[model samples]
Target chain A: MNAFIVIAVCIVFVYTVGFALSLWKQKNKIGAMAVLFLAVIALVLPYFSYFQS
Target chain B: MKQNEGKIGIRDYMAIILLTLGSKVSDDTPTLLYKTAKNSAWISMLGIALLSLIPILFLLKVFSVHRNKNLHEINLHLFGKVMGNLISMGVLLLGFSSFVLDTSVYVDIIGSMYFTRTPTLALYILMLVVCGYGAKRGIESIGSAAWLTLFYLKATLFLALIFAFTKGNLKFIFPLWGPGTLEIAKTTGSKLSIFADFYFLGIIAPLVSSFKEFRKGTLWAFAIVVVEITAALIIFVILFDFTSIEVISYPFHETILYLSIGFLSNVESMFLPFWLVAAFIRFSFYLYLVVTLFGGIFKIKEFEYLVPVFIVIVLFLGIMPKNLTYTLPYLREMILGILSPLFFILPILMWGMAKLRGDFKREAEQSH
Candidate 1:
């Protein structure tokens, strides 16, 4: 479970970063910012979850 | 991609459609089939694929004759300006609402199931952003992504099936026609109309490079998804036994889990990421369609700006129902009762109108 969470989060982080970069390149500022913001939140949320559990 | 200039080939269309339909795996569609049609669920699914073809072929015929017109424009040609715009308005609403519902369902599913302790709202926020980005990239980019994922998607399914065979007991789904033919047919009729979502075919048909590509793409995607789904359910019934099949959530994911348990402590690690990517692309397609169709309806300039707005609407919808159990049946009702038949029969309606007006004859004479 731990290993899976690590790998999954890492994968999401990578993709989210790419998604954000493309949105920026496309001149979709709002989209790029939203994704960057959400990526950070998503990555951080699980630790909060780990503690909750 | 030059195809971004509003043209896509058969392979691009095929990939997009496959990803869109195949990604429904996590929507618990297979489980619904098992429960609704029982051991004959696989066969019932074929019935669905058959049923979908009716509208598909009719629409293709419509496409073949009109050649250049899209669904909305065809509506205008066949129904005349005022009536066409009116019906197009209805289509715009139905397509947008249906896709929003789909996106919401997917968001809710991933959140509740995968990140049990995390906030679904947070997941919804994150996902809608990604979907927005994907939509902004336009359909061509989305199609290209689908094309890239095609190999990985097929290999995953094939691998899952091979593992399923290891412990699969054919008797689990035997007595081949487990449900009465009438019952199976009834389920197929009422529920499978949901597949009428293919009505989007007309909307997307004009975007592809040729009518032939659109037809082949739509039919092949429908056929492949049906076979993949049937194969998944057959394996599901065998692995879990019919007794537990109905109760299982996300049977395809479970099947993946069942196959992966030997090497991985958490089955989801291997499956969920891939499923999520597939789900992401599907959601992006729906998000893009919502913007495109609604923009067409309202004649909104720069519909790309509206992507975030629709994403907000989807998030609201995603959080509307309390949870999955409460929301799914309601969604099914909407699909079976209203959305499917409306969207499904629209092309046929257009075809009939065109025929009545002798539009085909007009086109033939003009060519001569």
Candidate 2:
């Protein structure tokens, strides 16, 4: 279960970065920056928090 | 009311208010009442309902005189440039904080009970995102969703009630007075935080058609929430008894957990969707209020874009607390101390200012 969640976190982080890059290329600064920022809190924090719980 | 292009009938308005009020019977309220009022928790509820009616009626009277002007517009009219905008901004902040507190409440139950392994912020984000989507859909859509889901919501409540009564003992809620008159009055004043949800009614007042519809819908919605909350408390007391609820944490969840309507072993599972949908309606209603508030405050003709920025702020606020233990009490204080006045006082102050200063007299004369 832990392994699966970790992998899920990695996938989400990767996808968000890719999405952010695409938006950045299109000059959508807010949308692009929000992706990476949200990933840190919403996507990554949950992984460590899972273990902490 | 100036920017509000949305029109909802009495039924839709009733549904929005009902869903907003009913879905809020989550664990926070009953537990707080149990801790405060003991066996006479319902008395505090009665006090809250009665006390709450004063603000609602006064705000309604203000709306009646203003006709089609919402709380924001009324504030602008009554208090003028600086004080009016300041007061409206306070209500706006309260609306944002309300959704944050509410989402955290839902996150508490979902994280501790169902998904022990899931991260709290993830759950918060998921709920907020879904709720934000619904909010972005606009008030008419939210109203329609509330209306659409009203039947299932009612059915779930009925099911929970049947299950609760079947296994509950009414002898538990006896003596008729938990903390007696004075203590209950104090608790009622403090517990008035629960009724702050109804403050949304003032924000959406003008979207409602006709004074008749507004009054009828508001009264009906108020009556429904009062009755429903009173019944929920009664059921909770019957099921959990007195002291058990104080230590148990989620009294309503625990009460409903005992329910098993033959074959439907975990009825809460079935009830979850109904709760989510109704809760989404409630969540989106506040979200809508905040966006409208920004439009009024910033003089922005286009607020559709700011919705996401505000949701980002909600996400930040919702996840700010580490957990429910640290979240509930301080939030209780803030809501009762700050947000309550913002929601309750600002509108009343607007009304009082209008009356004292005769600010709206010119508009009234011109309209006639």
Candidate 3:
């Protein structure tokens, strides 16, 4: 349960950072890339490691 | 002619910092520090207090470089419009979320402790109306109100502590260092949220009369921080055994309730009104920051017009959270941990970069 909570927290943190980056680079491709990177991390990291159990 | 060209005196700035520090001290720190650090909470608070100076020093550096510019204006100059706006928007959202979470927790405490029959939504609405009125009055009114409230707020807090003084046990505070230094440091990190309000200082610093006043105000603010933490630690040490303090939800409020005058009794009721006033000031300041940042980011000329719109949005968001239990922790972890740093760190970094690029010197010259 703690692991799940930690994972959820990380996902939320990454998502917020990505969102801010998107807003940061409104016209730049880097913003989109940042968002994509965060999204991928959010989706994959939890399932693959400590939260996998 | 700047919109808010009125320069506030040193006293006014002192009052603002006192109110800001006082607001957080009463609402959260007592209970939170008690829970996290247990019997050794006082030491933990001291540690946090010392660590908090880092952020203040960082803020002072930022203020020295950009004498009178608020975070929004500084960011725009430093990062350019798009990136700056992005950072400012993040800050706005972070402020908004914190307001909602803090207000909700306060309402929950009120409802649970005092007005059991009142629906939480009603409490939120009532709070919003009061805070909105303060925000609409502008910074001068807010600062003046803070000044006025400081006297009564401090008096009531002291009175409550005195009432609880007889019941305190010094033995409960023994073994000054907790289980380990590592544990104390970890708890210090968690309690660092109180200083998170320093982010708002960036927005408020320019409103101060002069650089000297701003520095003095921050020093006074830090003093208040130490006094509040010490007083709260003493109160918690007296009221609860170490084991019980850790499990308690609102240690300070619980202490207040445990306090009793010979005949009057129920003094916590008196505290509620004064505390509500402080909370209103705090909530309004954050709401105003959100609207102002949103306007600055989007290039909207009149942020004041968005006041009503954001009030409605704030009301909606405040109500959307299912309950205090779920929302409060989420806010502490996600909002404070992640979003707040963007507000505090980004501005300082941007200011540094801008200094490197000669923006601060150029702007200073232009203004002169």
Residues B1-368 of candidate 2 have per-residue lDDT tens digits of: 12235788898989998888876676577777777788888889888888888877777767777787777778887888788788777777666676677777778888887777997767776777787787777778888889999989988887787789779888998878976777777778777767776666666777787778988998898898889888888888888788787677677677667778888788788887787778777887888888777666655434444455555556655666765776665685567666544555655766687778764575588879
lDDT of 1 by residue, B1-368 (tens): 12244777898889888888777665767766777678888888888778777877788777878888777778888888889888877876666667766766766667666777877667877888887898888888888888998888777767777788787898888867877788788767766555655776566667889877787778788888888877876877888876688777667766765665475656557667767787778888878776676555544435565565456556555556555776775675566667556655776887798889898888789989
- Evaluated at residue B237, the lDDT of candidate 2 is 83
Per-model TM values vs. the true structure: 0.82, 0.83, 0.80
The worst-scoring run of ten residues by lDDT in candidate 2 chain B lies at B300-309
TM-score of 3: 0.80
lDDT of 3 by residue, B183-230 (tens): 778777766656767766677677788988888888887787688768
Candidate 3: which stretches are off by over 4 Å? Answer: A1-53, B1-5, B339-351, B358-368
Where does model 2 sit among the CAPRI classes?
Answer: incorrect
- Chain B TM-scores across candidates: 0.93, 0.92, 0.89
Better of 1 and 3 by TM-score: 1
- Tens digit of lDDT per residue, candidate 2, span A1-53? 56755675566566656756766777766556655575555464643444554
- Residue-level lDDT for A15 in candidate 1: 70
A1-53, model 3: which lDDT tens digit per residue?
Answer: 45644554455546545554555566544444533443454444434432343
Listing candidates in order, what is each one's chain A TM-score?
Answer: 0.87, 0.83, 0.47
Q: Taking the candidates one at a time, how many backbone clashes does each contain?
A: 0, 0, 1
lDDT of each: 0.72, 0.73, 0.68
Per-candidate DockQ values are 0.04, 0.08, 0.03
DockQ of 2: 0.08
